[model samples]
Target: MSKLAVQLYTVREEAGKDFIGTLEKIAALGYEGVEFAGFFDIPANVLKNQLDRLGLTPVGSHTSIEQLVDHLDEVITYNKTIGNSNIVCPWSEVKDEESLELLVAQLKKVVQRLQDEDMILLYHNHDHEFKKIGENYLLDLLFEKCEGLYAEVDTYWVHHAGVDVIEYLMKYKDRVKLIHLKDGIGNELKAIGEGTAPVKQVMELMQKWPIEWVIVENDEPSPTGLKDIERSMICIKNQF
Candidate 1:
């Protein structure tokens, strides 16, 4: 069975104000792990201590490509200390062929380096990745060109991009390491069960795919953010 986690980006403000307290609350909400967007400059040991105390796992970190390239060593060391083996480039500004090629080269090197250290590098996407640069989608080109790179598929964006979410996941199922179960209608982000995305079909696919984690994310949560994810967790628990 796939484990449940929350992308901390959903509660960035609360986390920034009270890091340890926020984590305690997350654990109280019954999350098995967390996908970190930032560490708030906390010491690795201190952060890891809190996680250990609460029995929360560090699912992965959403480290940017720029950080992965310039501060690769620091990023790797911090994640290692926190017991996280996955480093994902959550977003990048590569709108054209020249920029895309540069990102591919940069990521290829990062992926190989991380692999040598027994870690994996992954890429997350939004609607723009589904846009075609030539004959292929930009995301397809990235996976094709960058060897050993894994995917952290965001199902909401894949649906927003007018693609069949399950089919898209199937196409790259072998390379998928994590999945974001954000639901929404068109571009409006919503809690898991409150949107139009094919949640049932995707949950069914998880049974066949080697997906390690299914994370809940809502860029804009309604009636309070934490409460929204709490509701989402119920939806995920019922579905899975």
Candidate 2:
């Protein structure tokens, strides 16, 4: 019952060139939805029309906190048009413990404004979130403070930080409504379900967390990216 999607950021090179055609190919590859990054200068309505034409749903998107800070109205306006209700803050420039504390406070404001507009704000974690932000880990602190905040848990990062995906999911399942289904490469980056995420276990836990969508992504990829992704999707589907 865990249907799949792809984060367009995983194949951003293809999207930068053929936007709509790339979406067509994604659909052909059996992805039911996508997590967006940008419109590539295509008007919001045009982008929405093409996605509708292809029956693709926007499960989430990687948006900047600064933009959410400066242009929240624009952010909510476009997402609503695209049939998406989730906005993800992908990364921040903050470094070190002190900076992380400040970042959390800054992002809480962004989360609050986003919620005021009736949109869910998600924090997309990197390996750094494992470092402490306050009394708890940065991930825990952000989730605790940003009342409306949620997570787009990236399985690989959980493992990268030496945390168990199942344990983390169990601990914060309520805060996680979506997930980035990216797999690891032992010590490298590869396609989803291809590396070291305990992917099978992660899939099994879905019944409890009840994710809306699992988005396949790879920060960097092996040369056989498409083939690997295809295989990963097959692995996910057969988990039932």
Candidate 3:
């Protein structure tokens, strides 16, 4: 079964102010794991100790493509020390076929390198990725070209792009390791189970997939970050 996690990007502001304290709050709110957006420059070992104390699993970290390609060794060492094995490239802009090809080439190398270190690379998407280049969507093309590149599907964006979320996810079922169980109407973000995204249906479908984590995220938290995720967690707990 997939475990419950929250993307730290949802709580980026609070984390910026008090990283460890923010983690404590997340744990208190009943999140079993965390997907980190940044480390606030904390030492790896130190972060590991805090996570251990809080009983939180380091599900994954969103590392940039540039960091993965140029500073992979350091990125790998840091995450490994904190007991994380998934490194996600959260966002990338590919303006045309040429740029897409370049991204594919760079990511292929990053995938192999991560595999060498017993880690995996996953691509996170936004609505732009659903745009078609020729006959195929950019996202499909990227996955097709970059062998061993896994997916971290964000449900809201898939819906926002005017695609059938279930149909789209089924296409990459084998490669999807993480699900960003988000909710929103158009561009305005909402707490999970409180928006137009197919949250319930997706949660049902998730049980059948070999997904590792179901991470909750609200790109623009309403009111405050902690309160937004607290409501999200309540919905998640009710479902599970």
Candidate 4:
């Protein structure tokens, strides 16, 4: 069976208000794990304790390139305390070839540092990453150059990019550790199963890959964010 996690960014407002309380609600809602977007002033031990009490596993976190570059040690320490092994770069703006190359070089070092600490770095993508540079897609180029980096494929973004998400999932099976199971139609984001991102077909294709977590995220949630994710959880529970 595949594990289900919520990218807490989906409930950023509630989380910003009460991180531990929000996690308790998430656990109560039947999600097995959580993918953190921010810490929100909660102590590592306290966060871990809340998660433990509620039977919620810390799957990973969506960190930025700034954090990875500037405060890597601090970031690693916090995640290690919370029992999160994967450090994901959610998105970055690399407008030019030089910037892309710089980012890739930085990633190689980041992954190596993570490896030393018995952790791994994952790269998450958005539609902009699909733009071709030379002959290869930018996403592929980054992975190709970064020796031990892993992929946290976001399906909605892949669809938005007009790429075959299934092909990427299969081709990079070995490197994929998580799948961002967001839904969308065109440029608008939606809660899982609420848009036209081929949720069922993607789940079917996922069987060919060894994914660790299928995380639900809504960049643009509907109504109340909590309610939005609850609906997404129901959709995932029924279908996946």
Candidate 5:
């Protein structure tokens, strides 16, 4: 079965105020793992020790393309120290064919480098990725051009793009390793089950796929970040 994790970007404010404390609360809320957005300047060893004590796995990290290109050694060392092997490129601008080709070249190199270190590079999607360039969706061309690049499909964005989320997932089934299980209505984000992004259906498919993690994310958390995720966890637990 796929494990549960939360993208820390959902609770960026809380994490900014108290990084370790926020992680402790996430652990208490029954999330098995965490996908980090930023380290908040915390030392990797100290962060690892806390994660170990809290019994939370380092699911992945959303790293910037610049860091991966210029300071990959530092990125690797820090993530390795924290026991994380999956490095995700959270977003990239692919406005046109020119930009698409540029990103593909950059990611190809990054992917190979990560492979050499036994780490995986995943690209997280947003609505823009669904925009078409002639016959193919930008996302399709991206994956096709950049061999060995894995996917971290964001369900909400797929829905926002007016694409059938399930169909999109099926299209990239072989390359999808992580899922950003999100929900929203139009442009507004919501806690998992509180919006219409086929949360239950995605959960149903979880058993059939070799997904590493189903990561919950709320780009704009309402009420409070903790409360939002707590409610999401309740809904997820009920599904099981």
Candidate 6:
């Protein structure tokens, strides 16, 4: 079966309002798995039980780097209990070259600690990650410095940055385990298939890259997220 998952970030507003109820609706929509962003302050047992009832296996999450540093033990414990093995740094406040360099240095330590806990660190990238970092792009620099670090390559962001996603995937096939399967969301931050990303070729490369998961993430709202996401998921499944 296709590893079709909704990143859970798309419906962030709805989830923030009615977390478990929203999940029940998502589960009913034929999504095989989900990736968490927040827990809505629900207790771990209650959340875990709800996920169990929905047969929702959490593939990963968008956790803050600061939180991970200050509460590594608590963070790891919580993710483990929630049935998620991969805790990803969605974005950091690091923007400039100096900050990016410092962030990578810190990430090395974080990855080491997470390894000790028997989990992995997956860095999620945005359009800026492909921007020049002196000689190399920030994404490439991160890969170079952070050994054993797997990445969640956001296909849209790479496209937005004008980098060749297929080529990068080929360059780091072994290192890339997960992929965010949304299309282009340039300055406007459009929906899944509504932007300029090379949607078809990316999905084809994903299969060839032998990527593990194709997660749907839409940063902007459309008329209805479910319809856009469902169409994207359906298209990919049919391609498979």
Residue pairs clashing, model 3: none
Instruction: State the lDDT of candidate 2 residue by residue for 1-240, as single tens digits.
Output: 567888887777777888898889888889899998877888889989999999899898888878877887888898998888899999876556677678778778877777777888888988778886455777886677667788889888888888888888778877888877777766788665557667777776775555768788876755644555677777776764
Clashing pairs in 4: none
RMSD in Å for model 2 = 1.9
Each prediction's Cα lDDT score?
0.90, 0.79, 0.93, 0.88, 0.93, 0.79
Error of 1 at 158 (Å): 0.4
Per-residue lDDT tens digits for candidate 5, residues 60-140, read 999998998899999999999999999999999887899999999999999999999899999999999888999899999
Per-residue alpha-carbon lDDT of candidate 1 for residues 1-240, written as tens digits (9 for 90 to 100) = 677899999988788899888889889999999999999989999999999999999999999887999999999999999999999999988777888999999999999999999999999999898889879999999999999999999998999899999889889978999999898887788999989998778888887776768888999988766888899988887866
RMSD of 6: 1.9
Question: Clashes per prediction?
Answer: 0, 0, 0, 0, 0, 0
Worst 10 residues of 6 by lDDT: 184-193
lDDT of 4 by residue, 1-240 (tens): 567889998999888887888888888898999999999988999888888899998999989999999999999999999999999999988656887899998898899999999999999998888888988888888888888999999988988888888877888988988888889778888878888997788787666556757888898788867888899988877887
Instruction: Give the TM-score (vs. native) of candidate 6.
Output: 0.92
- As for TM-score, the candidate ahead, 1 or 3, is 3
Error of 4 at 26 (Å): 0.7
Error of 3 at 48 (Å): 0.6
Alpha-carbon error at 24 in model 1, in Å? Answer: 1.0
Give the poorly placed runs of model 3, Cα more than 4 Å off: none
Off by over 4 Å in 1: none
After superposition, candidate 2 runs with Cα above 4 Å error = 133-135
